[model samples]
Target: MTQGGEAAQHARDEGDDGDDAPATLPELYAAHRLGLVRLALLLVDDLETAQDVVQDAFAGLHARSRRLLPDPDRALAYLRVSVVNASRSALRRRRTARGYVPPHEPPGDSPEARAVLAEEHREVLDAVRALAPRQREVLVLRYWSGLDEAGIAETLGISRGAVKSTASRALDAVEKALEAKR
Candidate 1:
């Protein structure tokens, strides 16, 4: 097997075996890693810590890859939850570590995709970063990840009503924030 294949197999062996093996970390990472990293940046408000949060979240996901939710939407919800939780953990750890503050460096566009994603992508990224963490998470999951409110609630471990209220508050906050900048 290839190196990636071997790594995936190793990841699987460490997870529960009763369930059909879920998609490999490399596979999931290849598909969603960048987006998740970007989302983490918005949540944690620090580039390096955001990247670390994404990595840690992916590691947790890999450890439980075998027991993923059967529904793809639900699986995505699980991933979002993992990201939020991991980001929070990182934030807490950083707080305890004296004098550690994350730098506010925007992620660079991929050289290959830069020509395609240029200004529009940057605008969206900026908008997302300006949002409060709850709003940002709701926006990223709802719009970016294509998850419904229920899925978002399940992922975030909140009630659907909380999801709706938080998302509404988030939208209002983003709108007002953007309006004030105009």
Candidate 2:
């Protein structure tokens, strides 16, 4: 299976269990924060930035009135959008900094983390990271986050048609890149 397939399953597993609907902010955060962090991690390729992105997303939600976000699904969607945008901003800053630490730190920055992702998975991840930003974001959202086109469109603030086209192109690009490695 592909790395994205495993991530999709992982995300599904992280979702709220049935009959235990999140009714409060803390409950909602507990139910979905990790998934959001994983999403950001895929985009930014940095755990520290991913965590900060998630925390900042939650902070934004916390700053708003509860009345503004009463539904768990709505709250989750908001968080997804926030994470995506924040992840983009982090990427931009990283690029602007130029001389900063490179994305390709040779092997096992953390063996515990490396042990979790196989060499094949790491190869797939590096390929994904090499993609254009929008393509990478669409692929991660569609496959890793297990989000449908509408969800991606909403999260990205783009038209549904754009989401459909972007995901199609992104998938083809990923397929070509992976195949080229064969």
Candidate 3:
């Protein structure tokens, strides 16, 4: 059979055409886009860049949806991985560009000043931003994204034990940072 025929047959076998059908990419986007953006924001610390990261992740998933169809969970996992990777790329680019750019004065209304986050919340975010990339990713995936250890491990391409330990250490660091601020 042709590949298209095979895919159709697989979809049928999985009962993917009914109400119990797995979500399409658009549906997944509608449901999880904001959460994915929040996940990226936790990594990148810029809302616009975070949105771009999530958009790029969805585009990447759309490009590869043929192989990822029939299982919404797999698509979601692919999206999570894509967002993480894209955020990492953005961070790398930002870091490299920083060396070439002149430092500028802060905006009159910076994000922290413009927003109304609680003191503790702002402190925690500052601490999270100070964490190593891997530790920050672990904390965001574990806490903000509400992923299980296995899910975070799969998203990060790490072991579940690593996810657990990284989350522990990240949380400890956050606590210490907050305490030090007191």
Clashing pairs in 1: none
Query: Whose TM-score is higher: candidate 2's or candidate 3's?
Result: 3
Assess candidate 3 and give its lDDT.
Answer: 0.88
Candidate 3: regions farther than 4 A off: 1-22, 101-182
Write one digit per residue (lDDT tens) for candidate 1, span 39-154: 88988899888888888777776677767634434556677888888888877877788676679888876886786567556655777788878778988999889999999999
- The model with the greatest lDDT is 3
Better of 1 and 3 by TM-score: 3
lDDT (C-alpha, whole model) for all candidates: 0.77, 0.85, 0.88
Candidate 2: list runs displaced more than 4 Å: 1-19, 99-182
Count of steric clashes across candidates, in order: 0, 0, 0
**How would you encode candidate 2's per-residue C-alpha lDDT over 1-182 as one tens digit per residue?**
89988777776698743456686888888999999999999999999999999999999988873753566777888899999999999999988898676677666458777675676697688788888899899999988999998999999999989988887887777778778887
Compare candidates 1 and 2 on TM-score and give the better one: 2
lDDT of 3 by residue, 31-126 (tens): 889999999999999999999999999998889888885678788898899999999999999999987867797767667855745666788999
